[model samples]
Target: MAAVTAMLEELRDMVPLTAEGAAGRFAVQEWTPEGKSRDGVETSWHKDGIRGWIQKFRSGAVRVSFAVWIRDVDESGCFDALDAVYEQGEQALATFLPGIEHSPLTGHLAEAELTATDKDEFIAAREWTLDERVLTAGVVQQDTDLPVMVVVALEEPAPASA
Candidate 1:
């Protein structure tokens, strides 16, 4: 979730389109297996935890896929717009290496491709994936042994009254 949030923040800052008359506006949404359309960029992510020798140390990698849909009057211009958005997104992720808030152990653009296109609606869908390792806090342990001691107190009784 942290990685997703970081990616969303990065993508949300993109210009969306690089064409005249285009909306130049976009939205970033998290995608699920059964999600509907909303007219912007949709993203889905999966994380895999990596096992280490140390039990307290935590590490994992997150793979995020992004989909962007652009609508324009000209078919060719729509493709161009999609290209621009895709390029921008790639650049953003590339610069976002080493992670964001979570301090990813490693980050890079995994794959990018023009998954789908629709000329009738002048819409294009570009999907890309980013792989990154999550940062985790270090664990510390301490042990100690000490000798035990006990003390006893005695009270003196007064002589019986005559």
Candidate 2:
């Protein structure tokens, strides 16, 4: 069951992640297929502790994700959370904040874009990015996988050839 509550305020219109096999690449964002690297090693990962990964898919898109513990890693709850957040983009993302007296964190940024200003009223531990489309990704989890980690990302295509 997706927590009986709504997702973070920062996210809602988030496009939930589709199901994937264990070995499947959970890629929703675009990436550089060749010339960059064939391995899925995202050296540009800014955030630590469950960092965001950049993949190679010829899209040059980057992925940023945040994790929302489904109270207790429930599959239905994970999908439910994804659905709720998917329905409300920024609003759901905003819901992600430092946990207070709440038992077990319901939401926390597993990924995000950097801030233009050195200081943001939101989560401060995260790195900032000039890209406005960073947090605008979707809420998705590997199908049949642990529901503890919910993924989000943004895509930026490479510049046109000269």
Candidate 3:
């Protein structure tokens, strides 16, 4: 998981300033409508603005890196408003991860032992090749005027078996 750690450090640098040490590690682009009020006074509604932050990191060999896209209304208690968004994103990532039989080792799969079993079963049980190093992650929250990005850190994986 050294790759994961390196990405986390890079993300730490990407964190937006307003995260108040929350460390977003993302790129933020906010969009909102500018309009005039009843008195013809110009104003931009912070809550009306659509704010989003995206974080992505990938290394030379590894294909996929942990990523998060957060979009929400900017206002007091916005964190409360984004609770569902965070939960949904987290759950989706969890669902896409590989299973045990498929990920027993890192980057290499167990050789397809030739067994005189049903061809269908053999094919079904076959594992897809992928980085098997388990990634561990953490998040940190912040309070700032700009979009917040929770810092995500990954734990290093054990050395792979030769």
**Structural similarity to truth (TM-score) of each candidate:** 0.21, 0.32, 0.26
By TM-score, the best candidate is 2
- Give the alpha carbon lDDT tens digit for every residue of 1-162 in model 2: 121112212222333311121002322232222222235343332222334334434544434333432222445656677555434533434454323113132233234455454233322223322233333322333444434233443333343467
Candidates ranked by TM-score, best first?
Answer: 2, 3, 1
Candidate 1 versus the native: TM-score? Answer: 0.21
Candidate 1, residues 1-162: lDDT per residue as tens digits?
243334344433333211110111112232222222123322212222211110111221122222221112234446566455445534444343323323331243333443232122112222223332212121111111211111000111222346
lDDT at 8, model 2: 19
How far off is residue 36 in model 3, in Å?
A: 40
Query: lDDT of each prediction vs. the true structure?
Result: 0.26, 0.33, 0.30
* Tens digit of per-residue lDDT, candidate 3, span 94-141: 443333223333333333332343233211122232233223221212
What is the Å distance of residue 83 in model 2 from its true position? Answer: 9.2
RMSD (Å) of each candidate, 1 decimal: 29.3, 14.4, 17.7
For TM-score, candidate 2 versus 3, the one ahead is 2
Residue 50 error for model 2, in Å? 3.3
Q: How accurate is candidate 3 locally (lDDT)?
A: 0.30
For candidate 1, the per-residue lDDT at 48 reads 23
